[model samples]
Target: MGRTIFLLISVVLVAYYVYIPLPDAIEEPWTIGRKAAIVKIGTDLASFGELLGISHFMETMQLLMKFQEVPPTSDENVTVMETNFNSIPVRIYIPKRKSMTRRRGLFYIHGGGWCLGSAALLTYDTLSRWTAHKLDAVVVSTDYGLAPKHHFPRQFEDVYRSLRWFLQEDVLEKYGVDPKRVGVSGDSSGGNLAAAVTQQLIQDPDVKIKLKVQALIYPALQALDTNVPSYQEGSHFPMLTRSLMVRFWSEYFTTDQGLEKAMLLNEHVPMESSHLLQFVNWSSLLPERYKKSHIYKNPTPGSSELAQKYPGFIDVKACPLLANDNILRQLPLTYIITCQYDVLRDDGLMYVKRLQNVGVHVTHHHIEDGFHGAFAFPGLRLSERMQNQYLSWLIKNL
Candidate 1:
């Protein structure tokens, strides 16, 4: 009986390794050039086997399954303080470094496609503390409400409110930080919020805060056209893809009811507007070099009824890159990190071009051998190189 059991176990192991295939077409020599392909793959796979309906549950399971990857790390020099923004919870990480006299403040938003992330997520918490310790800065990671329950503007509102609270209450003082050196940073959806917040601060009269820097890692900056070359190429990456992104947006707009109609027709954006003009303007926002492989084609017209129903789809607020030059000019020194095997690479590149055109100081880093969500998986044995590089960059730059 023991011998038979051992043979069966060996067979199962062999079957798992040989018959059940690993995720395929994973880009080799991962670089920004392969972004579209990777993202698409991830998107499709994530949507397979009735997964879309249970995304929240699946996400929770994924987190739970990663228990081994979330070993406790010492944060002896870090003091954690919890606060509330309009009743929403926010956690601030303050490093108790004795050598530091003055420090930078980082308002960090976590990445989970705007629908699934929380400040308590192990990876995000770890990364926040790591940043505080390495940069000798105060890191505030907000626990904004998720989508399908909270929706589009609510998440944005929560983040904006949190930022206002941080500034108005002089919260940095509690963490031994200098207000003038305050900056915002995030990954994925959080990155989008960070960029949008910077744009909002640019126009607000009451908030005279000057952002010294903005750090965005694989930020979802645009929703105008997911058919961009990067989207087409990296659509199937392991972690994030275009379909999953669209699903996230759909879930966020659950209250809107007409989001699908708008997304299908691409009517969310106006064809004749200056916003569209700026997006296609190669000389100013997007350089000719980056547009080399771009294949621009006219989108099929959507029904007028659908257009009227989903006007929010094309609003520049939804797609930050589509924001006018006036807002872009006010942006501060920017650091953008792009992963090659991620779908959002083009969005980051396009935004970088826009910032450069507006004469904003920008530092761009492309991770050639990295995939989306690589930094968050620092604890994973397979992700060591990518995680280390990300940490090194944050420490050196921030």
Candidate 2:
């Protein structure tokens, strides 16, 4: 009986690994082996837990990602403080310089599909610390609550609240931050939040401080038209597959896992809101270089049924790419990063087109050899380059 049980376990494990085969087309060759192996293992274990009805795949993956987080350590160039702003947890990094004038400020948001990652993670902590140390700026990293537990608007609200508190006159004065030179930046889902918050701030009457710049690193900008060229070519790549991405989008708004499959089909948009598709029509918006050979197909009319069931899928809050032209025009100097091997590449491209059309100054960087979450892997040459480019832009702008 014991031998039979052991064999059963072995068979299940074998089947599990077989189900999630690593993609042969690895775009980032520098760390292909380690990247592919980690993605495959994490995907398999998360899926295995769900298959066994032990825990939801989202939670399992979140736990696995959080497992790698290291505790904060003392830094010679920066002083780190872990605290809360308006009940929202945040990590504040202050440079150790004795400057006569107020320093620039940045609100850095970490990305993990809105369900994973935190300011406490070493990747984000290091990013914030260096930005404060090297740029001689003040950086506030938000530790917003994860989804599948907290749900949509909650994460955005947490970020908004943290920003509102950080932007207050007393708060800026206490930290010696230059209110006029403050900027916001984030990656992946955090980029979505950064963009959303930046837009919302444009029309905010109560907030007197204006943002100077925004840097979005390979951000996921739209839920509509996952059929874009980049999605077609890079959806199967490791670290962040199209399936995992859509799942994150769905889980962020609702508990319904059923919404994911339909979302991937581009059926989440409501029929009444079909007009918004023109804003996201990549076939018309994307440049010839990005279009390549893939023919654009207008997405099928969205299902009213799905829209009613999952309304947040079509929300502008979820898709910053869908914001109005007026809002895009008032946006600050923007720096957007796009990776050739990332599903989010076209999202950034389309946004650049929209922003430029509206006369918003934009500095766009398209990394031909980069992938989604390239900044997540610190110490890697690719990651360092991305980080350096981001900081350089801030130094020049702020």
Candidate 3:
């Protein structure tokens, strides 16, 4: 019986090792291949759970990501606190050294496509700790609700609420934070939330304080066109694929499986919302150098029925790239990072162009050899280089 059980377990393990294949076309820097294989296996396991009917993909992925969380390391340079603000959970990291003046404050949002990350995760915790220590700033990382369970707008609301709470005079004074030095930063979907929040705050009548800076790391700024150069060229890259990204968008916006398929084909935008596509038209928005050989093609008109059913697809809050020039010009100093091997690369590029066109102070960094998820891993040489660039920017600007 023991031998039979062992054989069954070994067979299943072998099948997974074979079934979840790594990226076929590996770029230079073997570390990318290693990271790709790890991500592939991790993501595939979540999909496998859903296929087996054990749980939903998001739920499975959330569980898998939970295992990756590590308790905050006991460091003397920074103090960590887990608490709630405005009923929204948050993890705070503070530098231990006494400061003569108010220090800068950063509100951080974790990225997992809005469904698979936590502030407690090692990736996020390490980042918050480093930002607190290196910048000598207070960092508050929000634990926003996940999707397919909480849905769209809920994640945004959580972030906005926590940030508002942190921005209050009492809260900032307690943390010894300077009102003029606060900044917001996040990566990927968290970047989307950061951008959206920044835009909303710019126009918000209730917001008394203007943001000083917004640092976005490979942010997913738009959901309109998936046929852009990066999407077409880097779709098959292991870190983040076009199909998987559309699915993540669908999961965040709605539960309809059909809508997800339509989105993948770039058919969720109806004629009514077609006007908004101009903002995301990569051919016009992207620089010639970034366009390369990819030709632009107009997307087919989408189903009106699906469009009516899911209106969030066209909402500016969900796609910050749709914001007009007036709003763009009013935005604070912005820093954007784009990775070459990422499907969402153009999102950052176009945003940079739009911000610059409107006379907004902008700093843009394009990493030729970088991929989407590398910055989250921290220890890799590539990630470290990107981290140094980010820290350098904060030191100079923040």
Candidate 4:
């Protein structure tokens, strides 16, 4: 009788905990599904759900494995190559169809918030090949160095170097790709790189390379404000969150001093610089329509002591979207994808508005039923519909 009573009490405790409400921001249906999926996958791997915590490391691995099966398409041919850009690794995919004419070439970048991803990551590899097959284009996926160890300018430099090397090698001529049809593409962090690279190319007076377009998928274009409506609404979305994002920026800056600087948004940017206005023009850049559900609150002033402790946070390179109008206007025709349930959705939207304001051609797509990291699991049974929707949009735009 004593043992029976003990077991009943334990059962009641477990039931109570299970029925407790999650935090308001985390209560979205898609968020719940994402969290549950991570927990389920983690439990299967390690026999404990706690391993599925929402840190950058865990989330990165979860995204890597979300799509377990990727059907190989016969119409696409893939080859791995070593490149001259600091010996950076690259994978090239070309459509198998026989044609006499040169095709378009897309340089694809994989996303992992700049710290924990590779071009060889299954999702990106599959998508790269799929794009080649669907669009009859050549796709070159680059493997850039990660952050924390390599940090800020290194990631940007490596990507730029790879692009320069590709052009110098007469890649367009060797691969049967038209020089006029070359473009850049990436999702999330990769998207940010794509935008930055395009800007850099357009501004370079010596480089005569011409880019046809840039495709940014759920790109985190700006790091200036953490209070955007999408950030607040989807802060706890699985695979991404406000806190984890803070951590990524911290790691990417690569200095213990960088942390304090990042929080205050001043590590590399001086408060007196005119560039600061880019982050503050909320009314014009962010549409009032999207801000309807968001409560605009002024940022709390940082403690002087904390600002002095870390100075890397204010660097514009750390947050590329903070770049000046001179650079922004040089971007090519852009294709941007924004997901309604993603924390970074507003980042893409804001960029679209900024580019349009500068007279740059922009094409934007919004996925209403999508959540953060939806494209990573295109082949999964439960997420195929959303995944295909994303890929279809990409194919049509490409």
Best by lDDT: 3
**Decreasing lDDT order of the candidates:** 3, 2, 1, 4
> Pairs clashing in candidate 3?
none
lDDT of 2 by residue, 1-398 (tens): 99999999999976654454434443445465465667788878889999999998889988888777767665889988888899998889898879999999999889999899899887788788888998999999998988889887788889998998999999999999988989999999999999989998888999998899999988888887778898888788776788888888888888776678778886667669888888899988999988989998877776788778767767787789999998999999999998888888899999999999999999998877687878767657778887888888999998
For model 1 the local lDDT of residue 324 reads: 80
| Model 1 residue 117 distance off true place after TM-score fit, in angstroms | 1.2
* CA deviation > 4 Å runs, candidate 4: 1-36, 39-86, 255-270, 273-277, 301-313, 380-398
Mark the regions of model 3 whose C-alpha exceeds 4 Å error after superposition: 1-28, 72-74
Top-down TM-score ranking: 3, 2, 1, 4
Q: What TM-score against the true fold does each predicted structure earn?
A: 0.78, 0.93, 0.93, 0.78
Candidate 4 lDDT, 1-398, residue by residue in tens: 99999999989855543343344433244445545455445434432332465344534444555554333334426543434444777777877778689887888888887876676666777777777876778888887878656777778778887876666437678887877778898888888788888888877776677677888889877655666788787776555767666666666665464453545353333344434646644556787877886666545445444334433345555556776777888777788888777878888888888888888888777777665676665444425554555456546554
| Model 3, span 61-153: residue lDDT tens | 788778889775658999898889999999999899999999999999888898889999988998899889999999999988888898778
Query: What does each candidate score in C-alpha RMSD?
Result: 5.7, 3.1, 3.1, 5.4
Q: Lowest-lDDT window of 10 residues in candidate 3?
A: 19-28
The digit string of per-residue lDDT tens for model 1 on 71-100 reads 224468787767785576888887876744
- lDDT of candidates 1 onward, in order: 0.68, 0.85, 0.86, 0.67
